[model samples]
Target: MPCGAQAQIIGYDQPDAEGGEGAAQAEPYKPSKRAGRGKGSRRLVVQPYIEVNQVVTAELSPGDDVLTYTEVAAGIDAGISGQRNAVSASVRYERRIGWSDRASDGDAISGIVRGYATVVPGVTIEAGGLATQVNVENGGSALAGGLFDGDSRTNVYSIYGGPSVATRAGDVNINANYRAGFTKVEHSDAFVATPGGAASDVFDKSVVQVADVEAGVAPYDVLPVGLAVAGSFYQEDISNLDQRVRDMQARAMVTVPVSRTVQAVGAIGYEDVEISSRDALRDADGDPVVGSNGRFVTDKSAPRQIAYDVDGLIWDVAVMWRPSRRTSLSAHVGRRYGTTSYGGTLAYAPNDRSQFSVSVYDNVAGFGGHLNRLIDELPDDFEAVRDPITGDLRGCVSSLEGSNCLAGALGSVRSATFRAPGIAASYSRRIGLMNAGIGAGYDRRKFIAAEGTILASANGVIDENYWLAAYISGALGRDAGWSANAYANWLSSSDPLVGDVSGYGVTAAYYRLLTQRLRATAAVGIDGATRDDPAINDIWTASALVGLRYNF
Candidate 1:
């Protein structure tokens, strides 16, 4: 399951390959003739640029209006690669000036960074951050594609950091890791659709922390079978309704070698999982009190009521196989959280130019904790994909390790905690001078709320989301290039009033190097959203942009 550190430790027979004996013996090191010219050499690249563009947007439904604006932006892209550290980051700030009185002027900042560094012989530090904009539907869904021109847009910020220790004491290997994260959503309180409609409790902010430690010996090293012990702790504190979720577990594992390249593992453990929250304040008429920001007011004197509490024995069986260097698989079936749970990961790389991967996960967390975990799993070295007009980070990143996508996590922003089980797959390949990739996923969230509370209506509610995204880019020539991307999303909820929602968008861009320090770009895109409810109006818009950038 994706909820606890146990999921990360199961179905694996080898110690972490980063600083293990197997890794050190896999490759032979040769001394270089020139000093500071091999792996010790450092490489750095930094590019600062200024940009200017003109954007035009035309409304296609519910109204006939045209909006125009001039945008000025500045940004920097930097990367560093060495034996001890590897990092990459991009940041941009833009300000728009409208040409007409009815047009609204605004500014935005967006960026992404992920990296890791080796502080000592067997210790490493890793960190990442993300800042972006997203469109929020009045009902519940949040879309991260295309650009919107009104107050429906909001900013999201998240950051995480941790340290990992891996070392060997004689024959036993010790591994430990700890991570802390924080996430916040700005302007999320504008989710109230109508005066008398159902109130939407959007997420506010949260703090998440996770720690894991294990000691084990590989099979055939100390005995006929491998033996290990592990323990983990996970906690999340959500500001909305003062909610909290905590999980702690300890287990003993045994691994038996099935073949030269396969292993069977089994584990039994004790786990305690709890979820609790406070109720909202009430008025004289017993009606829930609403704050000025359109959210429920938390009663200071209210007690924290338990929504879920389960403690018992947990057991799991798993298999790990590595037939060759290009193929690997890990799968497990277990009983956790008082239910049957299962998850797995599969990765195949036929060659240096093509790769495929799939992952299935089961997790329980709030909006902030889920988002923080997604960021934490991103690759250490990657190129951030961004929307051309909005400058917001796209849901995916391109990397040599494997393409990481977040479409499954960005489906909803409701304040209630949920149990999420989802599956995602991605394929990427390099063809000549072109690169192409696609990702698709399905996610289901079952909300959990305390009975007899003001949020009782949300208890046991289920929401399902499906999404697809793809992109193709190549070089037009030595000094020119072109790219295109498209995405689609569909949402279904058990709530009748909320009904179903669907959204889609497509964008294409062309760029040419005009000079050694200057470049020109042009892009066009269209976006649309619709809901099954008749009272809500469908939205459609078309936009175009022309820009010039100078690198310094």
Candidate 2:
């Protein structure tokens, strides 16, 4: 996909991509009504294609030899759209064959699917799943995938779905949802290293469940501001570690129209959080260590819980402005996660052909909490599309899918229940036939294991991550095109058990229309990573490909 299409696939609400940011401002919750009769058989379409590429791998570190390989891949995509239902899905399979005896053959399967339907007048059903590889240093891509090997990639997949109901009680809008999902980490290990440099890999796997409920009543409309009382409850359960967390809040919310192009929202409330988990900690000799306080002595090298339960006051305030069709600014500041938290987004379109955005975020969450947030933001029934490359949902607000377009541009993430804060910025522009985009961001997270019950310890630690990405594409003519992308990422953790690492990669490709339904392509890419710890080796790999794709 082109840079512009990449932005659209990820659901970024850019000025030229989606008519502008005016389509992204927040709106009061309201029950969705059944769709009326419409024309055209709910738009439905299907596409299938096949491709082949020759790849070569090169290592920059000592004692490694260069290797070459060939890969064959095929995929299919389908989408549905209409007044009452929306759906999108795709699947791809690739096989890598090596020419050298030292290199092993492998295969990968990846895709994403999401859809929603109004089952009845006030009820909606929705589900979504993402299957992709996780790179050791750069996380993973939802579309154009990263390199895969024992050193750089692991398979991970997440799937979730549920039913939701929205109804009006007088002027109050009530909404509730119940969703269950599983996050599977296969053929992977969480390597733990002690202070002494001894390391071990423990299999990491788990199941997740989430539920939420909220209701709000708008009582006044005569003033420039509107008032509403809202209450919400959210809970998450992680089966592998036998952990559960809950959050509840009740707040008075106000929405103000500062002017024709400016708006503000404020909320104040009481919030509470609770967590529970099983206790099990052991010493080097395999003996349980008990603290003087009669709890298990937590180990710094192992997962430890924190007493995060909080019951207190919380407030949030935000403002949004679109002074012109080419510019937008929105920001929120508040007390959350038992701490002061803030986030914001700024978007500017200097002309008809370019758009830019920046975003900042801070929050505390339970296991699978991020996934829950994605599900919660979805409307009862809405039209949506996933990035054709990464297979990630574009978003849930109008065609924008909420402010999450910002998150998608920055790159998605994975974390155990924890508190995190981060910021990212991205810009995309098209000059004549050439298009480009760039993005960068950083994040820090403190994990929560278990609190008090033998799991609480003073050894709590945090993980920090930084990343940058860029892409450029241009047309050679109506029948031919070319594109290139580059990305880099670094990760560091306070815990001695986790290693610090950095990685960089680049890819370039050119293609031409061979026939009405066929195209020819050539591409090359590089992947490299290095670990700060001497025990972990540094490596580099490269690949090139020539392929023919047939589409129908």
Candidate 3:
């Protein structure tokens, strides 16, 4: 029941990871098995835990073409994207609401709610919610170093809560839960004109709102009869914007008996998407000059299109088999044809000690969004603008004309009203107190223009794909209480074959138990990226923390 705190940093390069739209909206983290202890009465139990987190380093380097991170120069990368030096404090609260157990003389009808707010008491039925809102910075979200010349300050909020009921009939057990939530993005804007002939609002203040609902069920105790079902539905709408969107998904899985020592399980799922946008770039030759003092006036161009509202569906099927308590093998296949598409993964495990796996995904959208998301842009790859005589491409726009051709051409401002498909996979293993994982995947993304967009947004065909990432983690000693982790990532484009990305980082930490319910921890890390001009060099970030837990 890893409820609230979600880790979306893995998607630093994924623009539309938030909503199907190519906007920088808040994203929620998925649930993890390590969230709660393994053994506990199924009936009604509550475990409360807390931890304090902080950032030790925040750095930003953009050598033109803010979208440079999307490139992959190597075959595979082990690096994590979105490198920043940000420091902020956050609190996570969550709860698992489930039915009671019959094996422990429990009523089997009761449940419990967990979180930082209020804990629910034991009862026949239970209801609760999970939410995590954090204020983060980056050029994409308009906070730190702006990517593609766009930067701002904003926060992401994600929340979902519902109710559930579970009961047993004869020799069978059943459980179900339903939840819904929203991801919202807010921003501010103004106008600017450069000598490059570019004149228009440099930023815009708008809000993108998206809503979703998800439900899951599991049945147990019936002759290898473990079964689960889940579904999700979503919609995205922007204020003062002209894009419409909708999405839905449903899935199921079950296990089969192949003897006490052997078991087989499989799952399947499907999803649908729809989106549309028609906007303008400039009203007239100099319509960008409407405002002179930083104020902006809406300019219009004829209605155009990126990718139409496309209805799409994709599915996945997989099976797993275990020969012993320590060994297992599984295969999964997925296929999708939509505005965004993806699929595949196979995994093998020899024991609790080791495993291997691989997978892939891709997504192509309409256009890109600019800083503050107040404007939309083109796919210029505009790295520089040289002076005809001086040959100097130095500095910002020299004038309004330079602005329109070079400034407006920044492609720094962009946002698509829709999305495309994506895929990914990898293998991981645990070896004598140490865990190592390495794998590779590719992303084929399409950038479309946002509806009502007045900036750029080439209404043509353009695609971006890249890959590479590897990682390893392990503990050095029990008496020394030290652990080490490392990884590297690389990316690049296939068609144009120029823009590329590569970086790696490593960290080591030590831990000590201060008390039965409390622990103290410390760690430091170094980072290096080839993409960084002059090589950003070895950046050292450090942190320390004390956490407590309670099982009630």
Candidate 4:
């Protein structure tokens, strides 16, 4: 029998490759609905556009300067939905021409793409990519809007691709998945102000790989209770300090049906996790060597030292409940990585006009691994949110399922391995002709470093981050509309030099259709940032934009 047919019979959904405490369980398959498309049909929409805008910015604090510029941009918004594939992408290129030398001029390319393609009856290909620009302060903090000076701007890129297989062998279901990802930070000059001196250890680049396989039988298929065996592997190689992390695990799971709407699950696993890195190069004076790019020079000849190593048995018990078609909940408490871990996910859709979702997660990884996992979780159908003034990705996507936000993952770019525990929630609703949504999250990281190394000072350090984003849009009659968005972020580090940082921004835009193919827009926004360090002054800027777009 085919996998799809077996899935329908046994109620076994696709296995989650990224295994953790809050793994997904067996559930009925739900088909997504595409606008103006029938079952098993194909549809594609592509819109090419050209835009021109006049922008002005004024520094509100620490200086009195007004700058003016003109922007020319070209972009395409495309989406395709078919029986075997689904894709959505938006790409844009913009050139800025300044009226004066001090106004700053440059070119930027920003975009996002995510999709999946079915290769065969039981195999599929999944891929995603992201490119955006951010302002990095000297204290290792990132600001959302890029209206600041050019010297503080940097670009970030990440891409991941993988293949997944799902099949059935008689009464047993088999599934497997593999993924490889690359992430890079370009022009990063951030540093930490230490009491001894300044330390430059920002994230540079990394490659991450993950794989998982599982074979199982549903309850009552061959026995009274379900049984399964699974194995997984994860690894990440960081260019900074030549750091590496590897984790391997194998487990056996059982499922017991408590009732028609609930089930109890238990799993016992053995896991081996290790983190290792080489020391930085040292000079004759016993000082670490610094490269021209303001980062520590890795000592290739030095032997790798173990930072963290744990090997032991892990166990967890979980509950899965589905009371209705619109409500589902899954939760688990486990012991892994030599510690207690707990996580869960809850989704509730009271009606067609509203949705609510919440998730809690715990993991140990570098910057690249966390980013890749978040991108992989995004839905295939979504609207990319962008800043109105700078046209940069806002770290979030709008969709009917819920707002998928990445603000927590992008909070810090430090080049150290840490254990992260976080929670995120989102709510979206349609009130008459208006649509509104809000997303909020909190993240905490505890650093881990080997003793007797240059990075020993960072050991046991903790950093906390909080972020919120909200947006609302409504129609202003037939061919006109308005939208507003606001965001805020807060960071607190145990290191005194890094201290605390906070930032907030808001933007509103109005558009009107003048003809069948032409549209006019006007927008205004203000962004501000503050740091606890007295030496670093506060920054505030206000910007305005007037633009026209032609669709082809």
Candidate 5:
């Protein structure tokens, strides 16, 4: 029910608490929960809503065209909660068919499903899936922050499911799980050629299959705090590209209480990872190049296909402190992903009415695979449809397809890997009938080349990026409200084709209750981006819309 105008800020760091992928979500003011509300023994709730909007858009730059269009959207939401089971789902479809120009017209279907079932007292089955398409920067998408048609778009879909079991053997608590999943990424056709000369559509597609299993056991009463040992193995097979990766890890973990208000955890482990790809060499005329070994020669100059393996001792330590009931601090340091990494989180409540948090992290991952892992960690709450820190929806959550999905998936495409490290902080509070928040962060991404990529080069594609954002929302009255958000992003890449770039976005929305189940809305948004690359021209875009929604 919390839908409104949204703007993605361009930034140098990961804008979310986890320092993960995707743009940040605006932290709108949240009203306090009404008092005396109680949960029903067994509850099921369903609602349906529809909206129609007339939008007008304008562009900056010479020979630009102004445009107008109508958007129609409909969706349903449902949730069921019981003593041993929980399920929630939402589905929505939207269409925008321009009255004149059809270049930017299309339809989108997005949804999420999450459920958990307890077959026995100590065993559970969990499943979920999500699909979404949105205009975003990076990831081989059409709407990238470049000079060409700035109205680009990308679509992503994924599904995963699995079962978990936990039981006690004497004083040891044991748990295990298995998961499988699939993911697909697609983008609109290119409006212009990339630096490598291939169309944007080449980096536009990928399909991956993932599977993994993990187990752990701990004997808490035997030690001051607790101790455990865990191990996991995962594999990934990619299509539309030639890449296969296998990974495994085993570790001994322990937690200890330092004081009444402080605690710490540490882990020591060994990891084994293997990455391989098929990159066939071709003759000048495009025929396969024969090698002395009677096998196709791998074209290393195009993209390295030789198998690469890395494994070593791994360890990490983390500490958590809660000096007071309303404040907490946590810090983590580890060595993983072929590098040393660290992260921490701090949360404080200045008063009963306001809260602030800061977080920082560093890690490396396959981009597409990391996105799936993020989805795997989503909360089961029905309204937790989108990432609160980053505006990205849980696109791939099909529980039916795999368990512990995303355990081995890598990069959104099979063409590259990313070592991402970043930090972010934000504060939010409510005063009377109004709520507001502000946040900022910086992220640096280093792309490592992979096989079967059509990109000119991967190492310098998307480099340092940073951003800042602010938003405010307040209740107009008992049944009305208004909100506004603004953000700016800057990018500096080593890639000549995508030099320094900057962008900004602003959006505002107001809604009025027409009835108990109906509402009217109006919104306006402006977004623009510029690049220092001489070959690319700067572009700006604006849009305004009026619409209505009804809830069942």
Candidate 6:
């Protein structure tokens, strides 16, 4: 099965996996406006505590292949502090012993077992997670997750279970959510990735994508003008691309009851994109190629893709004014007029905390995205997964239609929209009885990119670029017991189709409550980040952790 490669099995007759084929589901990856590794609040006390850490650094990390002595659970106490929401879960796995993508070499196993539901005041729900990832004989380049080689390496089977529903309707607040899932890839043969970039092609069946979702919403009382509606969807089917997606959003507000405090807000959305196919082809070493039957095109194989039929629709609108209680004014407009995308964001708030804002965006009118070079070199190495018959770079003319692509950097992104302006503020009081808060923000952006190397008959690489960022956060103590928190962030980019990155880090933590079910805790942090975007990239990293707990 590894002597020359040849096995085809890619399915998707409308079985979407956010790969496209709409109805709903495709938006629930919002865990990172902050949270790469943040352990800000802690509480535990009832008995038993043991947690440890040591991952001094990683010079070249290509998206977590961890466990070089990753030191696990170590132990656990109970829970209580920061208002005890006691629940626990653990389960893990992995294994990759060589060329795990130019050498991250790995075999990985994920772990999570859950049970936590004690943050009571009125309404609270607890949910846990479980996962499993494998790479036993990985030679890398399964077309970077489009999967063409799913056995003897790269087998990620996952199971996510859940239960979450917070309550409060009288005061205006409600919540509900659900997640269901499955991912399987087994190939005794069949892999493809080579159109000029010799070597690196394997596919023996894969293309089933689905990540589930269910939702409910309610929130309204004014303040910033609140009222929201929700819907979600997701799917997965490696290589052959059995995709799925679905989305829904809603909003409304009013306080300008003729200046009764000055408030007016609005929101609107509609999304539908579909793509289904189970007659897949891209057997390469065996030549099944086919995508619209033009003799194979679309970055030329191994998930480079070129099969479209995901209906599209997107829209947005906004307005706000609070002419002084302290001071306030806002304006925002957004739209994807089906690929004519527009943009907006502007703000000012004088009190009730503090505020300032300015922004412009239009992620490629139609959200046009057909990326490669491993998602623009995600951390490094993978000219379409190596050896593609000698580093093909997607059947080049130097991509971007060859000629070294770079199409005048798409005129530095003039109309595709992507502008930036920002300002933000936050404040909280209770210095003596303890309980404080502080925040800051800054933004700047201008970009429209699409360089090359995914085979457009070669030619056309280096689209457009420009970017910038800044951030900060703080916390104090005493809402009932103890507290402390801190944060920092910075980012950069000025073209090269967006490259150049920045980094900053800081964190602190502590909490206590020893009775009513016992609660006690402790924490510490020092994080890191740095990105140059592209070309001769540079890297610097850091990490640290500590733990102790017990409660309820």
Report clashes for each candidate as comma-separated counts.
0, 9, 87, 0, 33, 110
lDDT of 2 at 145: 35
Expressed as tens digits, the lDDT of each residue in 307-420 for candidate 4 is 999999988787778666666677878887898987777777788788888877787888788778777666576677777787877757775564377777777777888888
- What TM-score does candidate 2 get on C-alpha atoms? 0.75
- Per-residue lDDT over 1-552 for candidate 3, one digit per residue giving the tens place of the 0 to 100 score: 111111100010111112223122211111221111122212221233343322223233322111111110111101111111101111233221112231111010111112211122111111121111111121111111111112232222223333333334454333333333333333333322234232222222223222222222222344335555544444444322244444455555555544543334444566665554444333456453334333333323444343444443454443444333233333445553342222333334444455444333232222221111111010101112111111111112111100101111112222333233333444555557654444344333344444335433333323332333333444544433554444344433221312343434455556555566454555555444443335333222222222222212
For 107-220, candidate 1 gives per-residue lDDT tens digits of 888888877777886677767788887777755677764655877777878888777777779988777777788988775472444553455577888898888777888776
Q: Where does candidate 4 stray beyond 4 Å?
A: 1-42, 146-148, 190-200
Q: Find the 10 residues in a row with the least total lDDT in model 4.
A: 1-10
Q: What digit string (tens of lDDT, one per residue) describes model 6 on residues 272-299?
A: 4332323234455754444442222223
Of candidates 5 and 2, the better by lDDT: 2
Output the better candidate (3/5) by lDDT.
Answer: 5
Per-residue lDDT of 34 in model 6: 11
How does model 4 fare in lDDT? 0.75
Least accurate 10 contiguous residues by lDDT in model 1: 26-35
**How would you encode candidate 2's per-residue C-alpha lDDT over 266-348 as one tens digit per residue?**
87888887765554456687655544432233344554354468889988887767666557676777887777777776767
Residue pairs in candidate 1 whose N, alpha carbon or C atoms collide under 3 angstroms: none
Q: 5 or 6, which is superior by TM-score?
A: 5
TM-score of each: 0.92, 0.75, 0.44, 0.91, 0.73, 0.23
Judged by lDDT against the true structure, how good is candidate 5? 0.53
TM-score leader = 1
Runs in model 3 lying further than 4 Å from the true structure: 1-181, 184-233, 238-242, 248-273, 278-306, 311-342, 355-414, 417-421, 435-440, 450-479, 491-501, 510-524, 532-552
Runs with alpha carbons beyond 4 Å of true place in candidate 2: 1-45, 78-80, 87-90, 118-124, 137-145, 163-179, 194-224, 281-306, 322-328, 347-354, 371-416, 430-435, 451-459, 534-536
Task: Report lDDT per candidate.
Answer: 0.74, 0.55, 0.30, 0.75, 0.53, 0.27
RMSD of candidates 1 onward, in order: 4.7, 7.5, 18.4, 5.3, 9.9, 24.2
Candidate 4 local lDDT, residue 350: 82
